[model samples]
Target chain A: MNELVHGALYGTLIATAILSTIAMGIWFERKFAGRMQQRLGPTIVGPAGLLQPFADIIKLLQKEDIVPRDADRGLFDLAPILAVVCSLGVAAVIPFSPSIIASDLDVGVLWVLGIGGLMVIPTFAAGWGSNNKFALLGAMRAIAQSVSYGVPLVLAVLVPVVLSGSLSISGIVAWQAQHHWFAVWPIVPGLPAFVIFFLAMLAESNRIPFDIPEAESELVAGITTEYTGAKFTLFYMAEYVHTLVGSALGAALFFGGWDGPFAPGLHWMVLKTLTLFVLIYWVRWSLLRFRADQLMRLCWTWLTPIGVALLLVSAAWVTFGGTN
Target chain B: MQSAWLSAFAFLLVSTLVGAGLLGAASVLRVRAKYDSPLKHNTYECGEEPAGMSWMQFHARYYVVALFFVLFDVEAAFFFPWATVLREEGTSAFIAAVTFAAVLMLGWLYAVRKEALEWQ
Candidate 1:
């Protein structure tokens, strides 16, 4: 009974934190983008636009909803909901602190990757259900992009698992705490793997440079072409949540999550994650989007081979050099 | 540990409900302006009349890429368990894993030679 209550409490708390952060993240991204573009963003909403996301939410809620006459109503409605669910579901395994994880699954890394992979499904559903050519094109591009990058992403993740000799996120963090961050240690493999993982993370989350699915200039908002009002907001929320969660996962795997000097615990994790988040934003604003062929070639030709080689090298390091 | 998964599932359920509830509320709260026009219902095709159905056959590249991805994905799945035990398994295990990766790489190479990855 005690365990059940504690579990429920933590579950709710984490959900609240994620939801709130997502709201704020939207504001932060907008404000950050505004600064980059040399303009004020959302100044009218609340105190330097801190309340902008909330206002946007309210406005979205009040906007008239629309569904295309030819759309598959059932799947169209379910896709955004499923996207949000899958995006939020990944938070369950993430450990903010040593004692603060919602679920300490032995295969936490695998679990995250699996849940991350599920995002593609809803994206496809949205595209296919809309019955729009652009949406279908976007969905097809998204699947190809995600699946190609996913190979390297999974392989890169394996580098840490091989080094730590455990699939658990916390265990990997503990290993890094005991030894050194896989990102910095074993320079030959760790750095490359981390780079591949970071790039794959960006691609997987459909951020700029890899956001071919939603290339506004081309696809007319891609998979979301048919959605309106609150439904569109749901898809928007799902994308941001996925980006944030992917950043957190990246922090946990390669950046020695929640382990830092001067201070320790969840603060470090939050700082690391936010720092990565900021970096993602910076990258988003800075880089040009990759063409579909260029994106695929980068993944299959360069990142995949590097990822596979890094995995083998890490395995060899574990077999010979030996770490805790 | 088992309880943790339950907690995770519970969180998923709660979050889904919250999301659905929010959408439901939005539907009720939002103004309903029913402008009935065939033009409003047409798919946006850059101000031009949308020719034919959007569900026509697409390029075969997507299917080809998917096949390649599945092959690599299975190889990745096999590597996870091999990774977990690599530290203890030592050199022999390294050889086996390398062989597995090498064979997969050969397949990738073949795909490359065959232009399966070519975007054109």
Candidate 2:
């Protein structure tokens, strides 16, 4: 009973934190994009648009919720909820600080990947449920892109697992704190693996150079074509939240998660995560979406092989180099 | 350990409820346009009238990609245990992982030769 109460407390706390962070993250990304493109963003919403996300939420809440006449109502309603749930499910295992994590599962790495993999289903559901051609195309593209990149993504994740000799996220961080950060150590394999992991991360989250699934020029909002009002907001939030989780995982695996020198708590983790998030945003604003064929070719021919080779190199480093 | 999973489950449940509750509240609070037009809710295809159904068969290329994904995904699952034991088991484990990867690489080679990855 005591454990249950504690669990509920932590559960609510973490959910609230994630929700607020996502809200602020949207505002920051907008401002960042504006500055990058030489325009002022959300300046009139509140002081420098500090309250802009909330304003947008309020506005979305007040809009009419539209359901298409021919759409599969059940699946259409269920898809956004599933997307949000699966994305938030990953937050359960991520260790923000030693004591701050909700649950430190033994197979944390695999758990994260597993939950992340489930995201494609809801995306497909939304696309198919809408009964729209563009939505169907977008969904197919999303599934193909996410599933293909998921291979290299998991493979890149294994590099750290090999280096740390543990599958637990906390254990991985402890290993890096004791030894050197995997991203910097063994510079040969580590650097390449980090690059691969980061690229795969971008692809997994559907950020540009990899945003072919939702290419506005062609697909008219893609899988979200038939969604409106709060449902659309849910889908939008799910995408950003997934990005947040991806950035957090990247920071944890490669960037010495929560292991800074000056102050030792959650601030370091937040700083590392936000830095990666900003880097992703910068890339999003800077690059053009890849052609679908080019995206698949790059994933299969280049990224996967490179990821496999890097994994082997890390394994050899552990065997011969005697680090860790 | 059990409590940890319970807590994780509890978190998932609470988050889902909160999300659903929020959406439900929006549904109640939001304004409804009760006047329905047959033309308003048609499948949006860039402001054009509806054509044929959208559920037509797609290209076989997606299936090929999915197959490749499944192949690599299983290989990744096999690699995880090897990764965990690599430092302790050392050279023997490394050899096993290499052989495992080599076999998978053969499949990838076959796929390339067959041009399964080519986008038509």
Candidate 3:
């Protein structure tokens, strides 16, 4: 009974945290992007625009919900919900601290990768259901990018799992707790996996530098061209939530989740996750978007081979001379 | 010990079945009549009528890419379990794993040479 309650409570807490943090992320992303473009973004919506996300949600909810006249009604209505649900689902297995995981299953890593990757289905559904030329183009490009980049993303994630020797994420965190931090190791050494992971993280979250699917300038808002009101808000929320998930996962894998000294375990986990979140925002603001072909080439030619090589080197390191 | 593990697995299976059944029933019984509309039946546009068909056959490259993806993806899964045990297993096990990886690499290379990856 206690275990079940613990699971339910942590599940709800984590869900609330993810939703709220993502809402904040949207406000910050817009403000930062506007600053980069030399425009003031939503400053009137309460102190430094902190309440902008809330205001935007209220405005959207008040707007008249319009469905497309010729759209595939079922899928059109379903896509945004699917996107939000899939993104939120990925949060279930993530370990916030030693005692704070929602579900500590044996195949936790696989479960995350599997369900998380399904976000593309909803994205495609939006494109197909909207019945617009630009939406189709954007969705097509997105499908290409997601399928291509996702390979390296999974492989890069697997490197840490390889080092840790378990599919369970908490098990990996426990391994990191013992091994002087896996980041310090020399096998597939330095920060190649980390850098690759970061790039893949950006792609996965549909952030700038790899957000060609939703390229505003050329594709006219890309796959989300027709979305409006509360549905659009749901899509926006899902986008931010996915970003939080990617950042947290990256932190857990590379930055030693819940492992800092002088702080409580949960505090360390939150600090690391938030730090990565800020870094993600920094990269999004600091970089320009990549052309579609350039993005594809980077994934296949650079990231994938490096990920595969890291796996081999990591295997060799474990086989001979052992490891920390 | 084995019975304890088996019982735990059984419990998980039962719960999973119950959860799936409940979700299935709830979805079927929902009030669909109240929400049905002409706008809902049509393709999605901001407020106007939609233009044309949303589905178009994409380039053949995506299929090719997907095939290669499945090939390499399955191969990577085998390495995870081996990574955990390698530290204690020593050289003979290392050589066997290496040989296995080498064969897979050869298959990948052959696919590459055969223009399986020529996306252009």
Candidate 4:
């Protein structure tokens, strides 16, 4: 049809699909977490708790919308809305499979990184607007963690660009299909770069090991401390949506997205993305949170430097015709 | 070229609408209690009466680290163009980028040595 209508229509479709996928993620994590802790977990909601996430959403929506006194009402509302919007925005650029992408921007990698990085904004805003001591501190820690790892994250992502000599996600995937997946062929730098990317992704999403910001004992749920009901739920859902997008982006970058033996299509992309999503839970349930200093040290001293080294090595390899 | 951006803007508008729509529904569907207390709206503290203002000027630790992030993140952005053209430019691009990286690494080392990254 028209540009606005076409974009809106597809955007709605893609955003809804992502929201549903996030619902499934919530169910999967709960079930997985329950089994890990030796409990059945939410089996009462629907058939095997299939509908638990929706049920929870409805309940949350009906709860009182609490805004703390003197809270910056404008920004307090803006933060969670921005968080979810930004998370979903990245999905528009991701090349889900061969022809299944939404926008397919030539600078898809840039799209992913740029929008993904904006996540830091809503968080700091949430804390600032809340005007709570705990929320402010939590926001500080979360922003610190995300920004510190952001260097390595960009550095690591640069490796895939170096290998493929293109900034497009689909371009990288095509190059992998033609030659070898960066995950296996360039054993030296590819593996390490992927590992760094995964860790940075975890830190960016504020998952368990890097979740010092929301260390409930210390900050009382951190940035969302002053938020209640639906606003609070939006903040929570934003993180899950961020993780899901990161996983899909990771799958596209390193795991030879949508490349399979027998049937290569959207299913393989979904499978790979889901596999990484589960890995996130595995890390979350198994590990303890890092001390704030320890987390910063790990990013600056180790991941960032190592990420740079790997990027250089990959670039040198490609410059010298290694990919050819 | 313009179409791409238009579509992206449309996508953004649509997503915002969806978010606002959900929030609106929640506000519409929400339960408003009969009696409200000032205690409910007070910035959350651990049950004891809160003293002083919620906003404080302390905790500048994140400032230095955030500065480092801006430096490297911008530097990282510069690498994207160099990378896309690496295969074409070959060794020359590699050398130039490495020189740039080494300089940045030296700065990072200085930050580490100064204990800027340390939380304390």
Q: Could you give the DockQ of candidate 2? A: 0.73
Model 1 / residue A20 / CA error / Å: 1.6
lDDT of 3 by residue, A1-324 (tens): 554555555556776787777778778878878987899887888899899988776676554456566567788777877777677666666778887777776666776777677878989898888877778888878877887777888778777777777787878888888774566665353267878888887898789999999998887777778776666767777788788888788777777788878888889888888888888888888888998767876777678778777776766666664545
Could you give the DockQ of candidate 4? 0.78
- Per-candidate TM equals 0.96, 0.97, 0.85, 0.97
* lDDT for residue A254 in candidate 3, whole number 0-100: 78
Task: Report the lDDT tens digits of candidate 1 across residue range A179-286.
Answer: 899888888788889889989989988999999999999999999998888899889988888889888988899988888888867999999999999999999999
Model 1 stretches with alpha carbons more than 4 Å out: A1-8, B34-38
DockQ (C-alpha based) per candidate is 0.64, 0.73, 0.22, 0.78
Q: Considering summed lDDT, which 10 consecutive residues are worst modelled in model 1 chain A?
A: A1-10
Top DockQ hit = 4
| Full-model lDDT for every candidate | 0.85, 0.86, 0.72, 0.87
CAPRI category for model 4: medium
**Which tens-of-lDDT digit does each residue in B39-76 have in candidate 1?**
77677788888788889786888888888778887887
Superposed model 4: Cα runs more than 4 Å off: none
Top-lDDT candidate index: 4
| RMSD (CA, Å), each prediction | 1.7, 1.4, 5.4, 1.4
Docking class of 2: medium
Q: Which ten residues in a row are the worst by lDDT in model 3 chain A?
A: A181-190
Comparing 2 and 3 on DockQ, the stronger one: 2
Ranking by lDDT: 4, 2, 1, 3
